[model samples]
Target: MTRMRADLLLLLAAFIWGTAFIAQKYANDSMGPLSFVGARFLLSWIALAPLALYERGKAGCASLGKSDLGLAALIGFCLFAGAGLQQIGLVTTTATNGGFLTALYVILVPLIVWAITGARPRRIVLLAGVVSIFGAWLLAENGHLQKWTSGDALILIADIAWAAAISLVPIFLARCDRPYFLAFAQYGVVAFLGLVGGLGLESFSGEGLAAALPAILYAGLFSGGIAYTLQIVAQKYTPAAEAALIMSLESVFAALSGALLLSERLTPLALLGCGLILAGAILVEAEPALRSARMVVRRRRR
Candidate 1:
């Protein structure tokens, strides 16, 4: 039941994230990417502040030491890098493209865990990586190697950072059980960094902000605050690989959102690419159960 609830929460997060892609894309028309990210995350921080304070009070802050603070900052930096890159990438890429490319992080998460912890990844994960790589190439390369744009490169970098962030979450959850407090720290850090970058690198008017306000609110409240918090809570119960496999559905939801809301269309080849990525995720999710069933059959035969 706990795992089932976790899965449902993850699905909800995916839905919110998928829909937010359209909001993010629309915001870019009115503001610089960094500025949009800054404004959106600031709103998230604000929305989460009261809840975070309440959680900290209930849980007590004694367990949150200097090392905990440091880890929170690290996660926050990763969040900023990943999200900032994606926001910038969305400027030149379609929302559908951004959604699918970002999902590549699902394949990369196990590798990130292996690299960080020095534990070997499962063979199944490695195989999935190979398949996912081909799918990415098909999605990004427009029949020519030279056709890949700056946007694709940016989102690819974002995928790496996002993978690292996802792998690190369970580690942080182990140390600090206060998920709301951690959310506050990460969101606050991203907001601060984004604001500095926006002020230094981009200029925008109040009118532009007003125009982007609805999208900003949706992204901030639903995607950044609610969905992300739900993910942290869900991860406490679910294993990272399974969680990632389920969350990868965000790509499908994003594609659907792009079509329904933004009228974006994918080519037949691109749809095929989406299928491959989804197939890889499904394979990864089933690998453990398949291995168990195979072991049972072999033992019976012996």
Candidate 2:
């Protein structure tokens, strides 16, 4: 695919993920957090099975190597943990708070990448991180610094987990031959974990299942299946930094959707926060200005 097409797909994935916050909010109203996550992934795994079969043929059923399996399982655990925490947080937090907190993963990813690879982050990235955090604070605290809540704390932790999972992807994908297989494996592991947790704590009821069914289908098919596939494909064509920047738009999209669909009002402070978040994202991702400055410096040196 063209770079532009890949970029668009990644953006679409962000949009789908953003809108999913609302669906999840509705689903949580009627189901236990573990139960909801388990059901979503279970349905997602089943939905993606045919695609996996097509990619690997009948041999797709074969088990992964020990190392590959372990890595995949680890990734699955991270996924499960992050989503599980976010789901639990949603029980107490507003959807707006959840969205902003989750977007912190974007800022965290660069810092984690720097730590793991021993690479220094650019000035723009540092500025972006500061701006994004300020935006998050504004959105979550409504311009107050002293009003943070427990749900916000949980979501922040989940964001760290998400950043770790995302950073680990390039490493594993570089080493593994079958990205699709690895993806499916992670889904299976998470689904199992979700189901196990759900069984122990949740009271299953027909009405509850019915209420969460739409969210399950939406998250499974669009967010889980299509969005994930797009990420894999787009990451292949785009730089990790660029992909991360595009995906960070999830926060902006989520806030907009919340205001539009859920009648969540966007106060002036919230709008300013969104602008700061966008400014941070641009600072982190844009390279043209840096290149121009470099060219001017080289000309002056000559």
lDDT on C-alpha atoms for all candidate structures: 0.80, 0.76
TM-score of decoy 2: 0.86
lDDT of 1 by residue, 1-302 (tens): 37668878988998899788788888999988998888889999999999888887883564788998999899889999999999999888754466557877877888788888887777777677666555544554332233346897899999888887778888898988888888888999999999899989999899999999999999999999999888888888876755776677676677667768768776776667667666766776677668889999999999
- The reply for model 1, stretches above 4 Å from the true place, is 59-62, 94-100, 129-146, 266-275, 288-302
Instruction: lDDT for model 1, please.
Output: 0.80
Q: What TM-score fits each model?
A: 0.86, 0.86
Q: Give the per-residue Cα lDDT of candidate 2 at 163.
A: 78
The candidate that achieves the highest lDDT relative to the unseen native structure: 1
Task: Tell me the tens digit of each residue's lDDT in model 2 across 186-278.
Answer: 678778998899889888888998988999999888888788767766766665555676787777788889889979888888888878877
Task: For candidate 2, give the lDDT.
Answer: 0.76
RMSD of each: 3.3, 3.6
* Number of clashes found in candidate 1: 0
